[model samples]
Target: MQYLVLASRCLIGVVFLASVSTKVAGPAAFAAFVRSVRRMLLVPSGLVKPVAGVVVAAEAAIVVLLAVPTRATAVAGFAVATGLLLAFAGAITVTVRRGTRTTCRCFGASTVPLGPAHVLRNLLLVAVAVAGGVAAPTGGSLRLGESLVAAVAGLVLGGLVTVMDDIRALFHPTPASRRH
Candidate 1:
């Protein structure tokens, strides 16, 4: 159970760190993310940049909180992660239902349009956050070998999640194929 909780925390932290890093990589990257935010949500153009900033700040906070070696902070981190995932899922659902096909700038620039896959991914992350929160131990220690295994698993999972859109593209038909 402790290993599971640790892995979950690491996974969430890695995901958020990747997300924030991609968005803030450069001015153009950040701008693209803000544009995506504007397209996905119903916010006015003037508010889009600020909204993007808030999102990045929240993600950074999650990484920091999860890094703290305490059960309470871990729970808080999971709670924030879950809330953010739910919010993202809700926004993606609404955008998809509206027939919007803007590319999701979620991990930096990507051609994958906001769709059910994005929402599904977020919901799965939400489940992980919930499970981590519930299973967080008050205090514990792991053998060096066990810790390494859990850490590696978490990192691998997080990397997979960050590249989900690219993986989906391998199976999803191209625009030209759709016309056939």
Candidate 2:
């Protein structure tokens, strides 16, 4: 049970950290991704940049809050995850209604488009966050060994996901026929 809870927490922490790192590392790319979604949604052009900034900042804060060792951190993480999922659901609904094909800006500059997959992903994250919040860990202080291992695992997972695009491209080189 302890290991299960620890695993869940680590997964959520990794996900949140990855999501934010993408935006923080490439603000301009993230901003462009957001702008594309806004255009697809027909959002007012003036509001695009501000909205992107707010989203990026919120994601970063959520990652930091979730990574820290505190009881309240789980609650805070759940709230943020829930809010993001709801917002994503709304956006996906609108995109479907408007017959717009737009990429989900959730992961910053990924080429993956906004679709049912994105909605499902958020829903899954929401579930994980809720579970972690409810089962907030309580124990004697973490030994330095445990803390170090958890932190390293979280960072490695986050870093891998953050560079998923590059990683994929490296393994699956484009065919010459498709490269024009």
Candidate 3:
């Protein structure tokens, strides 16, 4: 149970850490993400920057909250993660239903457009957070060996999310364009 809980915490933490790195690489990259958000209609044009700020701040918080060794902190992190994933899933679902194709900017920069896949992906993450939160102990107690194992497992899973777009693209390539 501890392993499961700790692994979940690490997975979400690493995910946020990787995501934050890409986002804060520089203002240009962050601005691109903001633009993508506007294009997706996740927010009105005027509110794009503010929304982006909140998203980035939340990601930063997730990284910290999930890392601290405490049951309360872990639960808070999972709660935050769950909300973020649901919000993302909702945004993608709306875009897909509207027959709109827009880049996902999910990781600072990307060409993957909004699709059912994106919605499913977010749902999966939400499940992980929920399951972890449930299994988490009231007191975050782990031996050195257990902590190491959980961290390793979490990092591996987290890294997989980082390049998931590319992996999906490999299996389902975007159709090529041709000149008329």
Q: Which lDDT values do the candidates have, in the order given? A: 0.86, 0.63, 0.82
- Best candidate (score: lDDT): 1
Estimate the overall C-alpha local distance difference test score of candidate 2.
Answer: 0.63
What lDDT is obtained when candidate 3 is compared to the true structure?
A: 0.82
lDDT of 3 by residue, 64-92 (tens): 99988788888889999999989989988
Per the 3 Å backbone cut-off, how many clashing residue pairs does candidate 2 have? 1
Each prediction's TM-score versus the true structure: 0.92, 0.71, 0.90
lDDT of 2 by residue, 1-180 (tens): 233335456766677666766666765767666677576655677887777677767777777777676767756866786687567677787786777866555555555445665566667766766776666655445566776676566456545644554565576655321211
After superposition, the stretches of candidate 3 with alpha carbons farther than 4 Å from their true spots are 139-141, 175-180
Error of 2 at 71 (Å): 0.8
Model 2 root mean square deviation, Cα atoms: 4.4
Model 3 steric clash pairs: none
Task: Score residue 16 of candidate 1 by CA lDDT.
Answer: 96
Give the better candidate number (2 or 3) by TM-score: 3
Worst 10 residues of 1 by lDDT: 171-180
Quick one: ranking by TM-score, best first? 1, 3, 2
